[model samples]
Target: MFRIETHAISLVRRGLMAALIVAASVLIGATVALAESHGFAGLEGGTFAMGSGKHYREEAPVRQVTLQPFSIQKTEVTNAEFAAFVEDTGYVTTAEKDLDQSDYPGLPPDLLKAGSMVFAQPKDPVALNDINLWWRYVPGAQWRHPRGPESSIEGLEDHPVVQVSIEDAKAYAAWAGGRLPTEAEWEYAARGGLDGAQFSWGEDYDPSEGWKANTWQGVFPSIDTAEDGHHGSAPVGSYASNGYGLYDMAGNVWEYVSDWWIPGHPTKDQTNPGGPSKTLAEQFANSAVGARHVVKGGSWLCAPSYCFRYRPSARQPAERSLGSNHIGFRIVRDGVN
Candidate 1:
């Protein structure tokens, strides 16, 4: 009887262990799901005008595009969020890696340090024509140290994680079980239920009523009146959210899209138009042989006098291997389960 009782107690203990393991797994799964869905805003995507006739040539000849239901992050990926990914994955960003001298044939060996391009405001007024005047390639500048090696993200955890390359963005998206939004999807989301509006908020760029976004106020390259209350990149969701309840779609930082850089509009009305399947090098024979992705919206450097690309129509090419202080990204989830 004693032996039989002992066996029964051992079986009960084993059963309890199994139940505990299952419970722990369920809790972990719930935690991960919560983390992934934290900032995502669902959108019942539909057709919308993709580009603008009033913007740059690349944005001209606006075409209609239709998209399926999807979910996108309400705000750009924050530094604290990115830190969690890095801690979980132990991933190193491109800005943390040494520059490949082969890719830059004429660059000096000493100058090929691991860093990123940082936007340093000029002490005096400088020419808006040349962006090089204010933009500096600071060594040891990465997402952790946004300005340079000396800078730290201690107090800026809530701010968008800048200095992350397109590849890094993709990696983060993949880890989070999502992907970067296509150019069309990005524009559509940026529009925020408004069609062909000049700005994400509306047709007007007014800070007097209160800043709608984190864009340069006073002048380009030099004078920043801080009329919007922020001299540099503000924390994500600093301004009012758009119609779709999405924040920072206009400025704060340029966001990477999944599509490659194309100069012209779509050929026809496309349903869920993903940019050219071919890489930029393949699509444009004369273009540099590298991954050139489309970066949408604009950064804090964008001003009325200079680059007024803070609108939904504005688009720019960003090299995949490089990251900048003004560049970051948001993720999108296709189809709702």
Candidate 2:
């Protein structure tokens, strides 16, 4: 009788263990789904005017682009969300990894440390043509240590996580069961149903309307009036949402898009045109210093006199391997369950 009872108990324990495993799996699946869908705005995509002919040469030759339906996060990924991903996966970002010596032959040892480019505002107005006057490569500057090794994201949890490279953004998106949006998708969503507006909000851009987006309010790379109450990166959703209820689509940090960078858009209409697939070397005819991907929505460093690219049609090329303090990303989901 004792042996029989012991066997029964053992069987019961096995069954409980199996049941717990099943329950844990279900909970995990649910959690992943929640993470993917949370704070996402579904966009019913259609053909919209892409690029601007009036602004910079890169944005010239406006054309129509049709995109399939997709869902995008309401705001750029926040530091808290990225922190959770890092905590769960123990992932290390590109900026945190040591540089390959071979890539920087003969470079100074100190300059080869793990770090990222940060916007160091000059004390006095400097030449905007030379971005080097403001952008500095600081050692130990990663996403968590945004400003530098000494600076932390202590009070900036809600702010968009910066100093993340395209690869880093893709890893976080994969962990969350999503992917980076294409250039076409990002521009369409940034438009927020208003097809050809100058800014994300509308044609007229008057700060007296209470700063529609977080952009440089004073001299570029020098004096920031902080008229919008943000010296650098502002917390996500600090301003009003667009027509589709998406916030910070105009300014905050430049967002990464999947399409490779080309100088300008094709004039011909396109249906979800992902940029040219030729290798960066081939695309640039061997003139490019490095491979670059398109980053949209501009950043807080954008100013009227210097970088006035905080518009739906504005776009910029960022090196695929580099991460700057003014750059971050949002993710997108597609297809029905």
Candidate 3:
């Protein structure tokens, strides 16, 4: 009788453990499904002047463009959203993968560890021309560890997930059943129904009162006044949304677009302009072989004296494989839903 009772208790405990495992799996599945259903704001896309003649050279030759109706995430992808995707898919970011010496020929073997570029502010004023003064390539600096191995996403669940390569962004978008926004689509949505405005909100940088976005204040690479109440990335929707009810379209982190980087805008009017088809190799034949993608909307590091790219027309090229703390992405889906 004693032997039978002991065996029965063991079987019951085993059954309870299996049941708990099944319950946990169900909870995880539910969480992933909930995250995949992120809200998107619909835009009645129409004709708009795509580029700006007043800003950088790349934005020149301002041309007209027409776009189909689409829906885009109201805010940039947050850390919590990305965590859910990773949990569901077991996806590993490029920054987390071991570095290939073949891709970085001259880099030392010791420096070939998995890592991502992180923004480190200098103690003193530095020259604006060289970005190395502020950007540091720290090992283990993936999205979860924005600064380095010591850092974490503890209180940053609501903050935009940074240090994500274009490939990583594409993977997340795919899992979410969406795609990265085109350059024209991103710019059009960023405009918030306002045509050819200098800034996403309006013409003035700091109109009437205080800072409207998370852009840097004071000096670049050295001091940040934090006039916008944030030194780095602010929580999504921390500031006011634009005319079309989209948030962080001007400043926060530079959001990646689906289009590749081109030197300048097209002269002729384009219907849903999708940028050039030429590979990064063809476009940068004279330079390095690595191709780059277009990243729009300036980051919190953008200052008036240095990178004044917080405007809607602003754009920059980011290397395809590299991820930086100041770079992130949002998703868009075609149709009016």
Candidate 4:
């Protein structure tokens, strides 16, 4: 009789454990739903003229690209939204984790500590040719502590979270029941229904038309006059939304997209181009040491005289593992919901 009672208790224990797991899953789903409700602008996708022939060579060979309908976040994900995700999953960001020795083959042990690249504004004018003058690999720089160990996101809850690597962004998207938008989708949405337009808002960068986006008003790296009422990242949706009702698609931060970087776009028309499918070595000169992924949308660091990439067609390659102060991301769903 005692043995029989013990077996019944064991069965009860297993049942209770299963019940707890189901409850946890329900809570997670609810959290993600709340996160998604913040506003996901839908696009009934069609063929748009992608890339630019007038600007950077990387955005050259403009192609007629087609896409399926999709829904994307109206604004970049904020610190509060990311905080909820971290609280739910205890997720650790890439910059917070110790560097793997294998990734940095020749690096010294002392340099393999947790860190990320951060943009430090120079007090005086610096050389524009080399980026090393303004950008630094700061130890303990992560999304929560955006600047360094001394900084925190205490009051800037609404600001878009930065210093998140592509891997980190992907993890957050998965948790939120979405995925990173492809470069094609990002540009399409950024264009805001204005095909072949130079800027997301229109053809000109006229502040007289109204401060459409948060970008550098003065010289980059050395000085920011803040004519748009922002020296750095402003709260998400601080400015006017585009035609599709998407905010901050042109500036404020450079967003990560799910595309490996190549020098130029394809010469022919295509449907749902997922970037090149060639091996990493073939695409990046057969060298795997510094593989790069496409980062779209220029940041506050962009200036007309230096980096005029605050347009829909501009693109740049960033190291896959590295995160920076000026880089953040938004998410997209497969279809409009």
Candidate 2 structure quality by residue, lDDT tens digits, 145-200: 89899998777767888988788899889988899999889988888888899988
Q: For model 3, give the 10-residue run with minimal summed lDDT.
A: 1-10
> How would you order the candidates by TM-score, starting with the best?
3, 4, 2, 1
For each candidate, give its TM-score against the true structure.
0.86, 0.86, 0.87, 0.87
Give the CA lDDT, 0 to 100, for residue 79 in model 1. Answer: 78
RMSD list, candidates in order: 15.1, 14.4, 13.3, 12.5
**Model 2: colliding residue pairs:** none
Which residue pairs come into collision in candidate 3?
none
Which lDDT tens digits does candidate 1 get at residues 230-265? 887897778889998889999899999988876777
Q: Write the per-residue lDDT of candidate 4 for residues 1-337, one digit (tens) a residue.
A: 0000111001100001111111233334443554665679889999999999999888999889999999999989887777777766677777776756675556666547777777888999987866767877777898878999999877667678898878888888998789999999999999999999999988887788789878887776799999998987988888988899999998899999998878788899989888876475145632533446788889888888888888999998766667788889999998987
- Model 3 per-residue lDDT at 245: 85
Looking at model 1, the pairs that clash are none
Q: In model 4, which regions exceed 4 Å deviation? A: 1-37, 100-105, 278-282, 285-288
- Clashes per prediction? 0, 0, 0, 1
Let me know the TM-score candidate 4 reaches against the reference structure: 0.87
The candidate, 1 or 2, that scores higher on TM-score is 2
User: Lowest lDDT 10-mer window, candidate 1?
Assistant: 1-10
RMSD of 3: 13.3
**Candidate 2 ranges with C-alpha deviation above 4 Å:** 1-38, 278-282, 285-288
